[model samples]
Target: MSFATPSLIDAARSVLIVVDIQERLCPVMTDPRGVLFNGARLVRGARRLGVPVVVTEQYPKGLGPTMHDILSELGDGASSAVIEKTHFSAAAEPLVRQHLESLGRRQAVICGIEAHVCVTQTAIDLRAAGWEVFVVSDACSSRRPESLTAALTRFPAAGVVPVITEMVLFEWLADKNNDGFKDIMSLVR
Candidate 1:
């Protein structure tokens, strides 16, 4: 098993992926409030840095669309793309890969639901496809905390770095001298 060392500062070349946080899933996820808030903050921060954000709905027919709060935060922004997927691994979806390639983003910080299922598969597939994948553990949840725990345990060897939301944000900003630093710091706090 190979492990990946993620450089949090390389966020300029990274995208933010929110996976399968659909309406039905979110309500049952362990710690839904925290996950939703963190995902939103991460998306907002990604936008502030001009990083692209990609979201996937895991079969909207059954799960319903991505949660309204998350959808609102993305807000039809050009940098944000929503892909509807039937596959567990979003990387396997053509448009998801196409959008990543189009942005020239080779690294991503991934957050969302069912950490042991869709998130895990997407992380592995994304890495196999030659992208550096960082799974933001704090911003991700499953219906059971144990599932999230299992993913955090196993994903490193598959080349996904399990990280916290604030770590990614600060590393991306690098220093407080920049204008966006204060705004990001506020969000982190």
Candidate 2:
């Protein structure tokens, strides 16, 4: 029997999407600190590797802005863009779709809050829209643990790949010889 090799995320073809890890929503999540830590790692690693980042804020006026910690990791915002969205699925937002398209990438690494709602919907829609979707499992959460469990269960059938923060950082690095290797390693260490 022959098996095809699964694809790894190529830094050049990938974009990191931070979804609704906002001020008002975060403290209520199942593991807010873990999510924030790993999400920040993803953001910093993506920046160091030159991967474009897109951050989504769901009803920022109500939820408040993306948490300060995540925002701080974005590093001067030159390589990242934030879209304020009312839609549960960020892919359904015109501006979000347009921004992702403009990045010229087909692989998306996604993380953030309300896993069963915004995160899951966005992952499924992005997958259907022809982007290879990797949902960062450790960097996503819900107010309830069951909801987060449900979202992880739904991913396989919806064609979303579940991944962790370190998997993404090392994959983006691709080799120990890569220039960003030590910087990426430090995030996980």
Off by over 4 Å in 2: 1-6
Model 1 C-alpha lDDT per residue in residues 90-188, reported as the tens digit of each score: 888888888878998789789999899999999999898778888999899999989999999998677788989898888778787967988898898
Tens digits of lDDT, candidate 2, 81-131: 989999999999999999999888999899998999999999999888777
Candidate 1: which pairs clash? Answer: none
Q: Give the clash total for candidate 1.
A: 0
Q: For each candidate, C-alpha RMSD in Å?
A: 1.4, 2.7
What are the lDDT figures for the candidates, one per model?
Answer: 0.87, 0.92
Compared with the true structure, model 1 gives a TM-score of 0.95
- Clash number for model 2? 0
CA error at residue 86 for candidate 2, angstroms: 0.6
Best model per lDDT? 2
Q: What TM-score do all the candidates reach, one by one? A: 0.95, 0.96
